[model samples]
Target: MNLDFLLCAIRELKRNKRRTLALFAGYAIAVSLLLVITAVTVFSKVHQTAVIGTTGTHFVTWLPSCGDLSSLTEEELAKLALGIIPEKCKQNCENCTGCNKKPKDILNEGFVINTNTTRLLTIDLANEINKLPGVRNASPFLMFRFRDPTDNKLFTVGGLFLGHLAVETNSCGTNEIIEGQYLSENSFNKVLVDDGYALNNGLKVGSKVIIAEEEFEVIGIAATGADPVKAEFYMLFSEAERVINRRIHNPLENEANIILVESVNGTVHGQVMEDVMKLMKNDSILTSGCYYPASKAIGLNEKLLWVFIVVILVSSILMTVKLQLSFVAERQRDVAILKAIGWSNSSVIKQMLSESFIISAIGCGTGVLISGLLLCVVPVEHLLGIEMSIGSPFNALSMVAVVMFSVFSGVFSGLIPVLFVLKKHPLEVLRRC
Candidate 1:
């Protein structure tokens, strides 16, 4: 621990340039590998978590047997269907006497309906979920596989509408409009496409594309690090409904999917999930599920990433131990001579530890710098299979962990040699030399 003793030890190490360099190189390589692996693991987890969080709560889809519909009248059936009915229509229904009367009231009252039977449930929900209390926002969508009428090419597209709750940018967050305005509820003709989809189709803003017998003008583009498929196309909710030709009879009673819910005061998430499940239990016409951002797909990715990082750290430790042992063995004569001259074992240990610390620091610093530069220059989509965004707390923590690991490795390496030297006689070491 003495500065003078440590300096002297360092000087001795410097005198043997080859040995010193070998130890330095070994430490550096180990620390660098460990740091990179840690950073990558942390980054992946943070990125995935952000994607899931910003997208919405995950939910289980329960498709009740189609037979479930046979028992109910159209009015009862509409209540179980997932869709939206305009508020105006709901209030004006006092005059409706039958199924035909209900549709007439809805149309006359200028009500917009969402039918879960169509594929664009997500898109439709996004447009109207904001109107309800305890709702922050929603991403309504429909899942379907469709073919281009012109090319007869089949592709899966998620139909969605631009809503107030679009995903944010550069945060592994929600899918936001990056190039143009999001789909507007007032305008059902405009559409937004994902960046990847647009690239593949040779389309851009203002391009006209036809789907489901309707031509839509691409007005915007969006991106999702988590879902590359989102880039395919986004259209107005109404347009999506028309393409599929499904209608909703009741608004508040039916929903294809519900994502955002206001956090109730003093209510735990488990309680909320249970409540949601209970609410959907009797609605045999629909299915329901819930997702916690921390435990969903993003969380799984994070867990896997840490496993990868641990493997890297273990490998680094093994390599560092091997090299440090070799270095110490080569210096046995020097160590014995120092002990014979009244140098305490503690002093020798301190000097060795200092040398290891310096080497580890240098290695770790260089590795981190290189990693940061690489992250900056490399497009995240290509390197990590997810888009890279800055300012993730998870990523920052990983960097700190890397530095700590490097320091620990150096200290541990130094201890290995000290333990061996402590048990041996200086005379024996000298005689052997």
Candidate 2:
């Protein structure tokens, strides 16, 4: 009996091929749209994390060497007594050689001055910060500006610890190397110069460059454009210490002026900053991250995309339901004739549902194939400005979800109109027809 009903349903659909095709097209469009939106939503989330990583996700905690009032020299102190504000000197001393001379210039001019007690925090403090909750990793970095004796111009150098420099948030890792190679087993006395700096100085791989009165070989050229910890030259942390000791009257040990910190996943910039500030209460700590307007904009766009997906899903379902209602109305006379032939209401309902299931299954199957092909052929980056591809697992899951949802919608739509038509007697339906 079930087999007979199924055969009759197939014949009915075959008789009205145009009507069946129209209904299939509607279901196909809805399923395909859902699949596309889901793919984009997933990609947008992944892109957000990538964008944050490349930008200023990592916060830097640094003690500005000359910013402290006590760090000023006796001469500068005397000038402060004479009403020359020490704060102005600290902020604007880089260009002014007179009363506004900064501590950087003071150090470069008077190399013999001993200030061992100032300008640094121990690496142990960084280790402690690394152990804090929400902190991903912390690495101490040495930064200083040296006035070249040859040109009398100041240039900065950054000292990076080898193992710590390869963290996820660090942009100047091995991947930034465009020429030669990164520091390796025997990289002592070898440095990496920024591409722009190399171009300006006519330096290349194997070129000899003088830093802090010591000659070093350039092993790699890095294209670290506008990086947070940018410098003219980058060398091993130990080598930077050597240069610092050579340039100053007093030698220091295990100290770095800056500590670059990365936060764990899902941690916000404000939360990380608060944690670091609480840990280093008494120290003059300044924390900075890449939390700009653009980051906020990206977050807003994600919310909007989700809202759009919900709206599309609800509207598509409602439209398919309405189409099913109209289709059942046009076939009431046929339903009445089946009842007159002594067909049971339950059997009639099953046949109608069977037809709905077949249409939805074929439509959703075609939609899934179309979506897969579109994703593969389309350049996703052009639409979303992010490069991504659907993995096998996600693709398989997406098809299953679409098919399941289609089946539910098909059954529900068929059930509603079948019950509505079945409520009336067969004689009444026949008389009305």
Candidate 3:
């Protein structure tokens, strides 16, 4: 605990040069492995986020089940329609056929979708959700039934189109256009079909598909390993509005049946999602609403990285403990001599701990420095195949934890063995000598 004890520990360590070097090298190797693996893992996560569209973002869906379309009351239908037809007055009702009832005589029991212009059911709630303070951004996910021009059949349920920021792709990124070019950002009557859909339907770039009676040419085919279940079509934001506008002339064009709320910060995401659910719940138009769970594949490399770190640390601990116990038994005479002198047991223990601490600290520092240099000098991003937009190899928090664990291992390994040796009588310790 005092300067003399510390000096004595340093002198003892220098005397045991071989042991000191071995322990230092082992600890340094363990720390370096931890740092490099951790650095690569962090970069991989960032890259995975880019490759998978929506990444960790969750969504709350409001999918109106049209099976009970007939059950919706006049007021409910009116609200959902968003001014597609006259809310009242049978006199102006275009669907009023063969009924001789006057405008006042006809009862406003329920409303029906014309189903002619657009078969898609889009309920935009972007404006309401966007108002939430926690929400970074909110996009409407609209799905509609579009008739395939060749087959004259409606596309399956997942024919969704979302408002996306850009129409581009990288080698391992989302919105990957494989065969053809993406749709023009400002263009209408253009669609981007998924690879699976195009292949199944014998559709290709430049093939025209009919949605709500209008023909849209397939401009591109996009693929993403993240989204295994492909959509029938992906269209521009402008084109989606264009398609849905005919069926429902809503005041808010951004009204999406399914809302994709993005609040990436994990701490706020739960609260933000709660706020979003509260705001959109018990609505006049919604039949049902629920959170859309995200699906992402866990990378094998990431799993293996942690396993390796654990294995390395465990091995290091076992080796250190074994070596320290052997070394202490060999030095029993020194412990006997120290105890025979005026040195208290606590003072000897403190000196031993200090020696371990210094060794651990130096080794940890050397390893971390080497890891940083390796990360900077080696093209880690290229080798790992994930861009490291972040400058540091090891995250500050992770580095702190690694250092602490390493120091603790050294102290623990030395303490247990030294305590066992000190427990016996000085004469008994010297008996082996």
lDDT of each: 0.52, 0.67, 0.56
Q: TM-score order of candidates, best first?
A: 2, 3, 1
Q: Write the per-residue lDDT of candidate 1 for residues 19-128, one digit (tens) a residue.
A: 77776666665665566566666666666665554443422222222233355567764643433333343443331212221221222221211222211122333344
* Deviation (Å) of 128 in candidate 2: 4.5
Error of 2 at 112 (Å): 17
Clashing pairs in 2: 56-290, 93-102
Which candidate ranks first by TM-score, i.e. highest? 2
Task: Report how far residue 64 has shifted in candidate 2, in Å.
Answer: 4.7
Instruction: Put down candidate 3 lDDT per residue, 1-433, tens digits, no spaces.
Output: 6788778878998998998888678767777877777677666765654444244444433432333436557775554444333233233322222122111111221111112111222333565666777666665554445444456465522223334321121011134789887655455677777777788889998898776568888877777444322346777655655654443343223333344555543335556766766765422222112112222233444465567556655655665556556655666688788887867888778877787777777888888888888888874586676544666656676567666767677666777767877788877877778
Point out where model 2 deviates above 4 Å. 1-22, 37-49, 52-54, 64-119, 127-137, 145-156, 162-185, 193-213, 219-225, 230-232, 245-254, 263-267, 282-290, 341-347, 377-387, 390-403
Maximum-lDDT candidate: 2
Candidate 1 lands at a TM-score of: 0.54
Candidate 1 displacement at residue 324 in angstroms: 2.2
Please give me the total number of clashing residue pairs in predicted model 3: 4
